[model samples]
Target: MNFAVETPWVLAGLLFMLWPLFDDGVRHSPYPWLDILPSDAFSTGLTVLLRILGMATIAALVLGLAGLHRTEQSIEHIGHGANIVLLLDRSNSMDNTFAGKTPDSEEESKAAAARRLLTEFVAGRPHDMLGIAEYSTSPLFVLPLTENKEAIQAAINATVVPALAYTNISKGLAMAMSFFDDRELTGSRIVLLVSDGAAAIDPDSELQLRQWFKQQQIRLYWIFLRTANSPGIYELPTDSRNDNADAMPERYLHKFFTSLNIPYQAYEAESPDAMHKAIADIDRLEHLPRHYRERIPRQDLSALCYQWAVGLMLVLLALKLCEVRR
Candidate 1:
């Protein structure tokens, strides 16, 4: 009582194997299986038509499946969610040394320390998506919004402290926005911007960036690594930015974030523990509070399947022509 349509190629292959031995062109003698076939004029014509139909079907099936795979890949990169783009400045100030947990040898600069912290940080952040944009003279996506924590962590840790690399905050922010624009997001978006300072940028660039941030409704937060003028931070055996300097670095950062309407915080690392804590603070701020929303409905694919079915029917016509002359 149960019946179902078979796959086009499979059905064609089954018919093809049987058709060659039973068709009218197959010279009906005591021809093995041909005796099982009917000689009724109506049935004989029907069988011949189906034999030709089956061959055309097999060809259509092969091409249709290939087309499906191509379309799937072409549309694969579309529709991602709102993401956290981590923007970091890779200028020389990033190279100042700091002490790690055990202070003996010289520690790494803020950039290196942050990278190290990111390895463990990514392990805990599996639900949220994140991207990274490194800035010096220009900005580039070292990693895009991805759930692959290991790859993201490795890329982050590999970052280098400046050895006065160019500092281009304006360029970095704009590039991050462009990357995020490609995704499909319903949740509130944010950008976690970690930088030493942007004392080198053109004045108009920051203003333009600030306007863009406000217009887009993206949250921006700061993590300032103190090398000089920052309190409780000293030039220990470890290297650091603004180490034992004055309050200028943190103060300037506060004003910058304030002007952009971004929530701001600072961390001073004369050593490693302090640097680790800074990264921890960033992980804390990443919790996005939002309203629960409905999911987008799955796209219907039956139309595509129907199109394949129609294309196959057309190919079946070709077989009728191939044998009609005979």
Candidate 2:
């Protein structure tokens, strides 16, 4: 709401406003019996009024040239919502249906179902500041955290594009964690991971991720899209020889998250309806009071100044026409 000028030097033109006050160069016709005329107070007042209007007109013109504008500002907002980051997996398998095959007219791909449900989730939360991050072979920063619903929806819809070959979720989680950098913890901070598959994380990366979760105190939620005939997070290998991180990555990843000692939940979704329900549950759980600042963009006022100048000039023209001549 504060005002500023782009070119301060142009304001010097406002000095021209004094010209109307001091200049008495208007021509007058000679009158031999001027001393016999009676005092005219109305004319004297009208002359002063006209000079003031002239000064105002000049001042307006100078201000218009100065590029006046309102500076950008940030205002604090409080609402019942959480700061959430949508950490999505964009691997090749996400392009298939829940049955692990290309979708036909009767079925929808996992990514499509996720995009639809997440769009609805965003629409329902009016005050939540959400960010989008996707990971395939590497993590991609899609959008920053903001209260703009349209932008969040657009980023979700764009996830339906053909995905890459691999899923490096460890790096993706790191990127999602980075979104909260320099952000105040005024409310619940949640990381919602939507993925159909999992990959093994190196020991070094795993240690770093654990430290980050401890430092940030972030809540984690994983919506596991379980394809038909695939092993679930809770499933145990029948033979003890095959129970390792590489063999059952989904289970180990879940175990790693549980050991972090932060608030964490995992939902196994085998169909579109299950995905919808999981998203709904998340919407219900993240209703904590949040406080954040929203920025307002700068607005130019030069056009307003010019409009005022034009209006005053029209009024002065009308008064000039009413003057009586000798």
Expressed as tens digits, the lDDT of each residue in 1-326 for candidate 2 is: 69999999999998899898886224468877877888799877877888888898988888899999999999999999999999999999999999999999999999999999999999999989999999999999999999888889999988878999999989999999999998888898899999998988899999999999988889999999999999999999999987988999999899999998999999999999999999999999999998988878899999999999999899888887776677
lDDT, candidate 1, residue 305? 46
Candidate 1 lDDT for residue 185: 55
Model 1 is weakest, by summed lDDT over 10 consecutive residues, at 69-78
**For residues 1-326, could you state the per-residue lDDT of candidate 1 as single tens digits?**
12223233444434444544455343233445666765789766866667666555544454344332211111122232335777877877676653213223455566666676666766776555677888878786788766566667777876753434766767988877665664665455667666666543456876777777776677676565655444331224244554422334345435566667655454544445766777777677665643222223244343464576576566555544655332
Candidate 1 Cα outliers beyond 4 Å, as residue runs: 1-82, 99-106, 157-164, 182-185, 228-250, 289-326
lDDT per model vs. reference: 0.58, 0.92
- Listed per candidate, the RMSD to the true structure in angstroms reads 10.6, 3.3
Stretches off by above 4 angstroms in model 2 are: 19-57, 307-326
